[model samples]
Target: MIIGYARVSTLEQNEALQTDALDKAGCERLFTDHASGAKAHRPELDRLLDVIRDGDTLVVWKLDRLGRSVQNLVDLMNLLQSRGVGFKSLTENMDTTTPGGVLVFNVFAAMAQFERDLIRERTNAGLQAARARGHKGGRPSKLGDRERARIRELYQSRALTVQEIADQYHVSRKTIYSSIKNTR
Candidate 1:
């Protein structure tokens, strides 16, 4: 069975074009969603995944319609392949059921993974260089010595509530509590 999936980012956008293409491509069933690709949950897509069986092919008008990013596309392909299902992208002319298509998809997935690994390596190297320069990587402290002293004095005097001190210092109640604990 060939199942089609179509998506539009906003309500104003129409899925007619994708649906027409899918129908022409011999899609027996269709699922549609009016949601952003960046959204983590897509109801119709999830339903299609749940209902598709082994040996079925999942078709999309375009590769981007199925996933938000290259990594996401690769992940979805991996899942479908693991389940013995195939994938086809109309615009990309990709069909995972064929040897050439499989090769192409594999190459794309490898490139995405390589890019992610390179990014991670570069970020780690940058962080290590910063640490070597005695620069820590968290947010700078919001309260200084004077503020800390005032917080301690207020708490010790029991004249102001934690919330009151937080408002006076433009900090959060949690910050006031943490400062007090550090002083102790």
Candidate 2:
């Protein structure tokens, strides 16, 4: 039996890539976990470990998908070996059922961690460069400075309800409140 595992760390992270690959690889069943690797409790991972039987092969899209760190990966691989379950990583072409595959897994796991570190470093450097150019990276303001000033005046006068002001400005009450608060 071939059992696949898929995971995504955050809401913005999609599992389609992992799932699609697993499907193509002909996984008999796939387990998905939507939680950070740093998080200890992965319900689906626990479930997958429980149900996987001897002579079964566990597949993953990438080496990193299965482990949080190299140490954790080593521990997991050891556990899988003891249980008589084979492990395969599609991206690294690693299958622990073979002696060469076992050798490649360790090297590939380290390379995966290195690749992730490089990605994070590049992202941080890019953000720092953007900040240097005075770009505040977030959603653009809903209201302009002129409109904000007018909203502040109207709010101070207390002549209209917040809902009325919001309706007039075509924005939410929260926006109006924020605009008023920011000017003070």
Candidate 3:
């Protein structure tokens, strides 16, 4: 069976192009992921992975549709290969069932990994440059010092419930509990 996988990085992005392409390419079944490419969990992708069997073929419109990161794409490919499933990327013209296609996919996978490494390197360099300029990275605490102190007092007094404290402090119950736990 030739199973198709289509994905768009965001809710607003259209899945039409991929779907149409996959249809034209003769896919028998189709799955999709509507979340961002960087997200770790894609429900449709997971579902497809769970049911895909030996001798089945998985097809995608493009390499990016499979994954945004090199490690992710490589991992998916390895998993499919281990399960005796063949993979085909339309835009990249890769097919795991053929020897030449295997070589081409390998080279493409290497290049994707190299590109990701370069992105990481550049990001680290940028962060280091920002730090040298005395720009902190993380967001400041949402609660003011005085409010935190008051929260600690109220929590230690045992006069307020977690929910009440959260209400008074204008924060979530989880945040209130975390604050109390941290102070203790």
Candidate 4:
């Protein structure tokens, strides 16, 4: 039995490419997920893993369709191997049942890990540089310091209502309250 898996990063993304390849490769059933591959939570993949029996071959259009991380791919492969289930990747031309496939998959896994590490190193270096320049990361404040001060003054003086302050700042009432709390 050949069970295929397909995945896409977003709800709007289509699964045609993976599905088509899986079908062409003689996949008997296909599971899909419309979630980021980086996310650890993949319901469809989990479901596929649950009912897959020994002698069943889990097929994916590409290794990346299975996971964005090399470690994750290796982990999944190990889990499948322990279950006595085989694995195949259409694009990578790999089948775990074959000696050549094992070698190719290992090499690909190593390269993927190297790529992920490089990205992590570069991102950390860039973030450190940005911090040195006094640049803050993450979501920007709903209101700037000047706007918050004005809101505080107006609110204390009863010159502006909470609703009015919120409207002026183009923020919700909850955000207005949170801003006040931060001031304290």
TM-score of each: 0.78, 0.57, 0.65, 0.59
The regions of model 3 sitting more than 4 angstroms off are: 1-51, 59-75, 89-92, 181-184
**True lDDT of residue 86, candidate 2:** 95
* lDDT by residue (tens digit), candidate 3, 36-65: 888888999999999899999999999888
Tens digit of lDDT per residue, candidate 4, span 147-177?
8888888788988899998998899988888
lDDT of 1 by residue, 137-180 (tens): 99999998888888999999999999999999999999999999
Best by TM-score: 1
- Candidate 1 wrongly placed segments (more than 4 Å): 128-136, 156-159, 182-184
Worst 10 residues of 2 by lDDT: 104-113
RMSD of 1: 2.8
How does residue 66 of candidate 3 score in lDDT? 87
**Model 2 over residues 1-184: C-alpha lDDT tens digits?**
9999999998799999999999999999999999999877789999999998899999999978888877678778878888999999999888998999978866766776787799899999999999999999989998999999999889889999999999999999999998989988
Counting only residues 3 or more apart in sequence or on different chains, how many pairs clash (N, Cα, C under 3 Å) in candidate 2? 0
Question: Could you arrange the candidates by TM-score from highest to lowest?
Answer: 1, 3, 4, 2
